[model samples]
Target: MFELTAALIVFLFPLAYSPGPGNMFFAANGARFGFAATLPASVGYHVATLLVTLAIGFGFETTLQRSPILFQVIKWAGSAYVLYLAWKLFRAHAIDKVGEARPAGMWGGAVLLLLNPKAYVIIALMFSQFLEVAASSGEVIAVGWISSVFTLNNLVAFTVWTLVGGQIAGLFRDEAQAHLLNRVFGSVLALVALWMMFG
Candidate 1:
């Protein structure tokens, strides 16, 4: 149990803190819409992610791993969707201009889970590295324990980032600064998509 706990914490720390498309998008939304508005999206995103992790741990991962073409297809599709999100973020109204609420609903978040390569890698690695550490009898319990802990950690980390973005949203009352911020984050998303495709 101690070893499993330690392994789970180590994995959670890096996976939760690392900047990815989800984090970036959440931050951007928080900046555009206050944390209050971004809360649903954040919740939906992590919930969907947790569901995927659980599914993968249970055996869906084997199917994904065995089918190279299917993996590649999902990967490319997800990357393309991210790129589209970047464009949308870039085109959003200026910070000072009154804008509608962000559209990242529960389904949107679920769809993102499918496309997020970081999620794919983390799920694959978690099962490979951490599950191996457990005894055969400990496998099922370990997967559930580790996944629940990591999901909680992930939610907290991204919520904090979203709150920070909401706070910073006020700092960019200037249209120029807001535009620059959007461009920069959009560029980052584009880069991430390229990396997932080629890296």
Candidate 2:
């Protein structure tokens, strides 16, 4: 099954490594806060990714396939939520105490997982490509393995992105630089939100 594992990694690499919602969210948090501070949100997101992806692999794939409008509704709601987050970041202070300009935390991560349309679509596509079309002999085991791989891949991507953001933030030498960086991150998040909404 090394072939299957290798194929799965190859398929997941672009999706996981690219700057999607999860990566962007963590990057913004890591830029504003610190890497350690974003841990709760990361843990929450990855855990939910495992659970949600497994559920989709097992049965929820058909439900999403049948309800196209429902996906649109979720897309709008999630985009709005991410936009709100961007607004908050836009108003963020340059150098604040802990919890003043707080991170998204666990609930935000979980909510993003449920609302983010790309997430559902990606999981569904992965299942269709790997589980449905290819015809695995052991579906239960395969689904579980797929879920784990997806979660682990995402965790690594988020970690790297968070570190990248942290490094950018580290380059700030003064309040002015920090403020500029904060606004830049906010703009990036806003653009990402809009793309998710309309793109």
Scored by TM-score, the top model is 2
Point out the worst 10-residue segment of candidate 1 by lDDT. 94-103
**lDDT against the true structure, each candidate:** 0.78, 0.84
Candidate 1 accuracy as TM-score: 0.90
How much lDDT does candidate 1 score?
0.78
C-alpha positional error of residue 52 in candidate 2 after TM-score superposition, expressed in Å? 1.1
TM-scores across all candidates? 0.90, 0.94
In order, what is each prediction's RMSD in angstroms?
1.9, 1.6
> lDDT by residue for model 1 over 111-187, one digit each (tens)?
77777766877887887877777646576787787678767877887887788778887888788888887787678
Clashes of each: 0, 0
| Candidate 1: residue 8 Cα off by (Å) | 1.7
Which sections of candidate 1 miss by over 4 Å?
99-101, 135-137
Q: Name the candidate that leads on lDDT.
A: 2
